[model samples]
Target: MPNDHHNAPQTGLSYYGLSLLSYLRESHPDLADDADFIRTRAQAAAEAYSCIIRSGGSRIEAAEEADTVLYRGLHFSLYGTLANVIRSEFADIIPEEDAREAALILLPQAREVARSYELADDFAATPQYALLYTELTGTVQILLDNGIQ
Candidate 1:
């Protein structure tokens, strides 16, 4: 730590974080392409592994990067239970399909419906955000596999 009257703390942003944002930006069209929105989002996300591979980053790293942003974006207040589950089992996994699956099982039958409410009206509404949410969704699957859901 450097403390000087003339020098303030240095400033910088994470390239990985920026890359996560970039990956998120890529999801816009995918969601907007759906007729109902849910299917569109799911499709876009289902194919995220392929997309990230072509986006100049490994799918695992890309997914992890995206997840990192999500863990921060929602202020760690959302998906807490599901997140714990993911970490418990597939903490080493990339996007975490297990978690995503778990969330699906709970959604439409429970009150854990934050994506449609907290994010946009649907996936088509916010492309980048939707993509990020998808990553989070996969993390939920990881949790489900871990018996979190």
Candidate 2:
């Protein structure tokens, strides 16, 4: 073995984090702008991803592990944060209850998308993953734009 690991393309936490941030920026700028919150969660995800990769896990495995860490309690933490942001940012237009409801609804879908991405090949480069990301982001954008149904 000629230190082949070094030749491996970067395909773990960094890629996942950037992809996540990009999607959030596009679909949920409020969430994306929460640097302290996002960075804290991303750090935890990166740790999980790094641990899995260090243990000789495949990229998919590492991503799955990272997602698990990242989304642990998404309904509570992520949803609550989003709800707060929506409530405060759009207080005049969107009702607090609607913001809460939207956050709750979006979280499960977000988790599903994360799971789908973990199962896809080539990380974010695969068409399947790209499609999932696009669909989820679109859904988020729509919910934010129109409020919960």
Q: Quantify all predictions' global Cα lDDT against the true fold.
A: 0.42, 0.58
Q: Which pairs clash in model 1?
A: 98-141, 98-142, 99-139, 99-140, 99-141, 99-142, 100-138, 100-140, 100-141, 101-141
lDDT of 1: 0.42
lDDT of 2 by residue, 18-76 (tens): 65566554444436555555566778888888999999999899888888776554323
Give per-residue lDDT, candidate 1, residue 145. 69
Off by over 4 Å in 2: 1-14, 26-28, 73-149
Candidate 1 residue-wise lDDT at 8: 19
Q: Candidate 1 on 4-97: residue-level lDDT in tens?
A: 4212111221333333333332332122222333333333443554467777887787676545433333332233333444456456763565
* Candidate 1 segments exceeding 4 Å error: 1-104, 108-123
Tell how far residue 65 is off in model 1, in angstroms. Answer: 43
For model 2 the local lDDT of residue 54 reads: 95
